[model samples]
Target: MISGLDPSGGAGIQADIQAVTALGCHPMPVLSCLTVQDTRNVYNATATDPEIIRQQLECLAADSPIHAIKTGALGNAAVVDVLVEFLAAHPDIPLIADPVIKAAGGGDLADEALIARMKERLFRHAEIITPNGIELTLLGGDEDETRAAHNLLEAGCQSVLATGGHGEGEEIINTLYSHDQEPLYFYIERIGGEYHGTGCTLAASIAAGRASGLSARASIAQAQNYVLRAIRHALKVGNGQPVPDRGIPWET
Candidate 1:
């Protein structure tokens, strides 16, 4: 896992570790940045030195067998460049990237330059890039979700999973777009109330599923189910949004 550190433990590396572990995978967390935030909002963030991030990746790569890589809230373009380099060297490792631009409770996590770098470099190396409707539009540079997904596919991402949590409706329709197959949709009932760490948990769960040898479609389906359950058992740790109960018991 490559992401920022959220002291509140609702999202970022903390959520990633919990989600990955709950899915029966070991999380190799690498911090790309640090944030001062609570369940309500992100007040500020400081990017980790690019060289430090590179060194951590090298050490982890050298010591462990990395099955899959997942990333969230990379603070800047320099961090993205570091990841791009690492991914390029290990072309076979599957990557699941959550293009987190804004916090769930409303705060900017990534700026335009970082988003541009992700689209131009980091995304192409990912096996699947997960984005909410708004993120899809921003990353793909198109107002239309379908068109935006295609734009990403054209830019070399193997697959694009546009999450529907931010969209209007009773059902959350997460759509998966691939170069060789028709778009696949997973319809999940919309759970009421706002929750933090959902995007982080979902991306990590997908990475864990892939690492466990599930097919991309199967991985995505299982991840969605996991997130649903987690949300259903959300933890009200603070006065703001509830933190996802990522450690909740899995249903069959």
Candidate 2:
């Protein structure tokens, strides 16, 4: 997994590790950046040196067999470039990208340049790109959800999971879009209250499932269910938002 480090442990690499482990996969984490944040908001972030990022990825690849790759909160274009190069070298490794534009609490995690770079480079290598309503709009550059998702697909992403967490309704409707296939909708009851790291956990769970050899559709279903359960058992570690209990056993 390539992501930032969140000290609060509600999200980022911390959440990715917990989610992957809970799903019975070993997380090979490569830190792309570091954030100074809490459960409430991200105050600041610093991108890891691009060379260091490359070295870490190289070391991990040489040491273990990477089944899948998941990315979140890449702080800058340089980090995105590194990932693009890595993905180009290993095209067989599936990529699950959570286009984290802002924190769940409230703060910009990625700027316009990085977002552009993701679309122009990083996203084409992705097997699936997961983005919330707001992120979908921003990344796809269209206000209409369907158009936005389609825009991403046209840009070369194999699939797009446009999450409806930021939408208004009794149920959260997450739609999966791919070329020539009927859009699949997963209707989840909207759980009340603010929660952090839900996106990271969901993406990581999907990566774990893919690594375990599940089909993309099956992996998405299992991941959604896992995240729902984790949210139901959220931990109120800070005064701001509850953190999903990603450490909960998978069988539960």
Off by over 4 Å in 1: none
**How would you encode candidate 2's per-residue C-alpha lDDT over 16-55 as one tens digit per residue?**
9999999899998989889999999999999999999999
Q: After best superposition, candidate 2 residue 122: deviation in angstroms?
A: 0.5
Model 2 residue runs over 4 Å out of place are: none
TM-scores for all candidates: the values are 0.97, 0.97
Best-performing candidate as measured by TM-score: 2
For candidate 2, the C-alpha RMSD (Å) to the true structure equals 1.1
Report the CA-based lDDT of candidate 2 relative to the real structure. 0.92
* Count of clashing pairs, candidate 2: 0
